[model samples]
Target chain A: MSADRLIKLELSKLNVHLPERRPSLREALSSARPQVVARDGSTHAFKREELEFLAGLLPEADRDKLQLPILIALEPKLGRGTARISGEAEVKVVSQVLEKEASAGELLIYRPEVAILRKKLPTTTQYLFLW
Target chain B: MAALAVSPTRMELLKLRQRVGLAQRGHDLLKEKMDALVIEFFEVLRRIQEARMKALEQLSVAHRALSMCFAIVGTLETKQASKETRRELQVEISTRHIMGIAVPAVEVREVERNALVRGYGLHMTSSVLDEASREFERALKLLIELAELEGSAFALARELEKTKRRVNALEYILIPRLKEALKFIMMRLDEMERENFSRLKRIKAMLEERG
Candidate 1:
């Protein structure tokens, strides 16, 4: 029982690095120092160049729709080496970066594609583990 | 693996099943963390390779320029000029978290300065000396960026190792032991139930014989 409790504790601590509130692209671009606070009270900063690149991908009206630190959801049930990218603005920007045809609001990408997306947009992208 | 010490009862079997479920969940989540860390590690490694090459090339170029200055402007005079120049350079260092690991984020302040701002007297230092200074300044900037990339790679690699260890422990040790204990309790309960059934049957036969 004690061992089981410890496992639960470890699971809880897994996502402490995630931000309390994710800022939109517009809000982050307008700020002098663009960053979001994590649940653990640490700050995660966005690079200015990455913000500009993301902004350039979308039009003026879509800036607010795109959120900072676009989450790539990783679920074990999805099978190994697969991840999902959700949100319309996020999918649009990611597809443009990867040179893939933009799908709907969600995109299921394989391992190689994930690597390309990460290499292209390191600061603006984050991995989110879903049980 | 040794099965856990517990009385073989239905209630204990229920608790063991729950424990096995929790262990499996933990193992899966931790394996996912390990996979994510591997990706992060390789990403950092890729950047570090590019940064290292750039920094090394710039450093060699700076060294060549310095050699030229020493040959043309006289070694003693070049040394004197270097001594007179202002060498105070500052870098802003901070932490950026990737997952839960804190990797270094370094921002170098303006390192390249013009001839006048270099603080060495204009007449004493020749154009060759200025060229050397400029090249060295560029090399310094590249080296700082390289350092930041290398630091992140190391941090990521360390975290990857740790997560891998935890995943292995769950997969190889904890889960197997729990399952073994669950199997033991289940088999014991079945045996006890059969014995009770036969004992009640014998008692019923004896009562019928007496009647």
Candidate 2:
């Protein structure tokens, strides 16, 4: 196979584990068992502890607005190692966890912060690749 | 004259050189990736070893507890309790990509902890058997987690080794041979052109002298 083709295949496989669509935080919390199906047809469950942490971050009204498995955007343009955390409540919670200053709207996190966020909320957060 | 004769073939040599450079870069990057994967694999393996030991120890403890319960409550009653207990334990398993490999996300429900949803007939029920069942159930959950982790670690390790071999082959053998072939072709092409140019010049001089 050509090098380009191999690289394309590798890049395509990077996000196969991501859910087609994320559930609302409220829906996830209310359900007896909260889980998502991956592209490869496997179920991934959300941890109760991570859900509770998310609950503590947002108001009751915002719970429905906030989505489970908050996307951590990994764009190549942002350089190889950096990632982004979007959404107001998601940013707030992540910022607090990483002990960083909370900015309004989206947050541009470096690689170390991204790693920390992932470590803290492995099930509740997922990496999103943007072209 | 020699320089002019070899000028046309220089372009091919330059192109071949660039290709070799790209291949070398790719090999280096892949080698680095393989090393990183090996490191990650070994780390996971270490964790798995610890988890396996702990889980097996806990399983044995639970089995011992169950045996003691059987002795106290009678064998038939303990067996009956085991049969009556709800074993609808579901694990929500999902795949997470580590590098290129898929690893399972095993999530087990807290089955044996629920007190209100009692199993077995009320008349035949003994708290000792329930305790035994619960202990065994807890151990099972831990064992399942350990199994998933160990399985993933092993799979990742195998993949890492395979990738390392490929990287080594490309770096140490294929790329080098291609470069050598390319160098030989360029040298031969240059020598042929030089000889052709010298022959042409001598013929031109002889014709001029004859004229």
Candidate 3:
């Protein structure tokens, strides 16, 4: 195959680990079983400890507003080593965990921060690739 | 006859060199990636071995406990208890990406410790069976986590092997062939230019002599 075609194929596979749709945090918390199917037709589960930690971070009312499997955006344009944590509750929880000051809406994190977040919430956090 | 030749030969040589450089860079980076993946894979494998051993041992212990309960509480009653017990345990699962590999998230539900929820009938209920089930449930959770980790480790290992092979091919074969071809072309171009220069000079000398 041509170099261009090979690179395109590699880039296409970058986000095959992500879920088609995410369940809301409330649904994950309430359901006895919570799971999401990946693009590659595999099932992925969330940890209860991470869910509880997220629940503790927000008010009871915000549980429904927040979503499970908080997306950690990995965009090549964000540079080779940076990722973003978006959404109000996600930002708030992540900033608190990393002991960084939380802004209102989104949090831009470096590679180290992303690694730390993944370590802390392995099952509840997923990496999403953005063009 | 006097028209200048563009000589795209030089341009092709430059482009070929650049490609060779890119291929070399890619090979080096991919080798580094494979090394990192191997390190990660072995670490997970070590953890999995430990987890599997512990989980299986715990399961055996639980089975022994249940056997004792059956002897003490009557086999019929014990079997009846297991049937009546609420086995509605659910796990919350999701996927996380590690270096482009998707690994399963296994969050096993905490088995209820409540005596009522334990669901063993009072007639021949032995605390031994409850304890056994609890232990087994805990082991099951740990085993599931280990399974997920092991599965991911295996997948990553396979991908690492494939990447390593590609890197090796580029470094040891494809890039080298391209460079060799480029060198051959360059040598031929230079020899042709030298011959042309000598021929032109000889023709000029002959023409001058004849005039």
TM-score (all chains, Cα) for each model: 0.91, 0.61, 0.61
Question: What value does the TM-score of chain B take for model 2?
Answer: 0.81
Regions more than 4 Å wrong, model 3: A7-131, B1-8
lDDT (tens digit, per residue) of candidate 3 on A51-119: 888899888888887876888876555565567888888888899888899988989987667666766
How are the candidates ranked when ordered by DockQ, highest leading? 1, 2, 3
Clashing pairs in 2: none
Q: What is the per-residue lDDT of model 1 for residues A58-85, given as tens digits with 9 covering 90 to 100?
A: 9999999999789988877898778899
The chain A TM-scores for the candidates, taken one by one, are 0.95, 0.90, 0.92
Of models 1 and 2, which has the larger DockQ?
Answer: 1
Per-residue lDDT over B47-72 for candidate 2, one digit per residue giving the tens place of the 0 to 100 score: 78888888888889888888888899
Cα deviation at A9, candidate 3, in Å, is 5.4
Quote model 3's TM-score: 0.61
lDDT of 1: 0.89
- Best of the candidates, DockQ: 1
Q: By descending lDDT, how would the candidates be arranged?
A: 1, 3, 2
Docking class of 1: medium
lDDT of 2 by residue, A16-74 (tens): 76787888999999989998877756667798989988889878888977787888877
Off by over 4 Å in 1: A59-61, A99-104, B121-123
